[model samples]
Target: MKNISKIFMFLLIIAIPQIAFAESSKIGVVDLQKVLNESAKGKEAVKLLEVEFEKKKKELDIKENDIKKLEEEISKRGSLWSEKVKQEKEEDYDKKVKDYRRLQTDLKDEFQRKNKNFTDKILSDIIELVRTVGDEEKFSLIMEKQNAIFTSSTIDITDKVIKLYNGKEKGEK
Candidate 1:
């Protein structure tokens, strides 16, 4: 057992230099969310998305108000209303609720689709930019800043990536 321990220590000593060398590799970190928030194209995309969101919000609000009014009427006058009338009102309310729920789901899906499109395009461009930067700057590895804990500013290439990505976005526009 002692001989095995000695051999293990010997192997560990031999591996130290390789571990040190690996740590010395040219690694970079990029803050992709920062790039998306600060870049011109990203700003434009957000603004457009917000417009769509607001437009849908207005429609939902109007429908919601109508539903509220109907509910109030049913509640206040339902006792005096004929049985058939009360039943019709209840059915109408139910249908409106169903429509509202369906519309909400549809809007959510539409927003997600738009968001995915923007993200997919932006991420694809960022990947290409990262590749170019990696090749030009001779980076051995690049990781997202979101996953990092204590990366030195010297290895933070987020600004460069954003600049390169924005340049490409400008050219494409």
Candidate 2:
């Protein structure tokens, strides 16, 4: 009888802790995209990228206009000129068109590369911040809002995290 009591007590001790831990564990969902879009640092990063893209776009437009003008000049007087002059004009126009096309391709590639780099950096930072906040708040699980089909407002931590991230950006750490 004494041995039986001791075994029961041991089992109870083990089970009680597990039950308590399960009850106390907290789970939350956050909209990562929303947080990133709303955060002050994210906004600043977007603005910086936009400014750079605009400058590049303007340069591309100017190059395109120059190419168009060269093409028009060549077309208007090609047959009226001597063979040598016509051939030279055709060569110049071809070279200019090729250069313009190459420049346009490079600009597009560069813009994509820059945009991807900036997005990756921002996402990495946001993930770090989310983990830090989750650990500090003792969240047992944190899920992205996109992955979750539904969650109650009480379990939604999107707004709180955005606030915290913005606050940190403002030197309120």
Candidate 3:
């Protein structure tokens, strides 16, 4: 009788972990990149950025044209110009080119900084929404789909997250 009780105790101990695991909340996956691409706010943000970039590109093109014309004029009058005057003109052109390059660099840096900030803000909001959904759905863990090679549809929460995010953005509860 004592041997039977000991055997039962060992079996119970082994079964406890399996039972706990079976009852535990499941891990869910979300494709964050897909969410961002499909979200309405994300699409709008992308369009705005593209427009701003195009404007800056146009401005740069104008500056480039001006520099090219200056160089052409200088070359055309080279035969009639004094060596010192030619050197001065070349120096002025070089300075303008340098300044334009600096401006280009600054613009690029500013664009990158702004883009990063914008994306970070959006991602933060999305993360909050994801957390809320996970909590409501009793998810034990929520992983990014990008990190996972495969996940069952039962555990995929991408659409739910996107819907929640967009709904919040639209002032929907």
**Which structure among the candidates has the greatest TM-score?**
1
Write one digit per residue (lDDT tens) for candidate 3, span 10-125.
Answer: 99999999899878957999888888888977887788888888898899889888889879978999668999989998998898799889879988998898788778888888
Residue 122 of model 3, lDDT score: 82
How many clashing residue pairs appear in each of the predictions shown?
A: 0, 0, 0
Model 2 lDDT per residue over 1-173, tens place? 99999999999999999999899999998888887788887788789888988888898789888878877877897778999998988898788778878988998898789777877887887788879978999999999989988888899888888887888778853
Ranking by lDDT: 1, 3, 2
True-structure lDDT of candidate 1: 0.90
Q: Which 10 successive residues of model 1 have the least lDDT summed?
A: 161-170
Can you tell me which runs of candidate 1 are displaced by over 4 Å? 1-24
TM-scores of the models, in the order given: 0.84, 0.74, 0.80
Worst 10-residue lDDT window, candidate 3 = 164-173
TM-score for candidate 1, residues paired by index: 0.84
User: TM-score for model 3?
Assistant: 0.80
Clashing pairs in 1: none
Model 2 ranges with Cα > 4 A deviation:
1-22, 151-154
The candidate maximizing lDDT is: 1
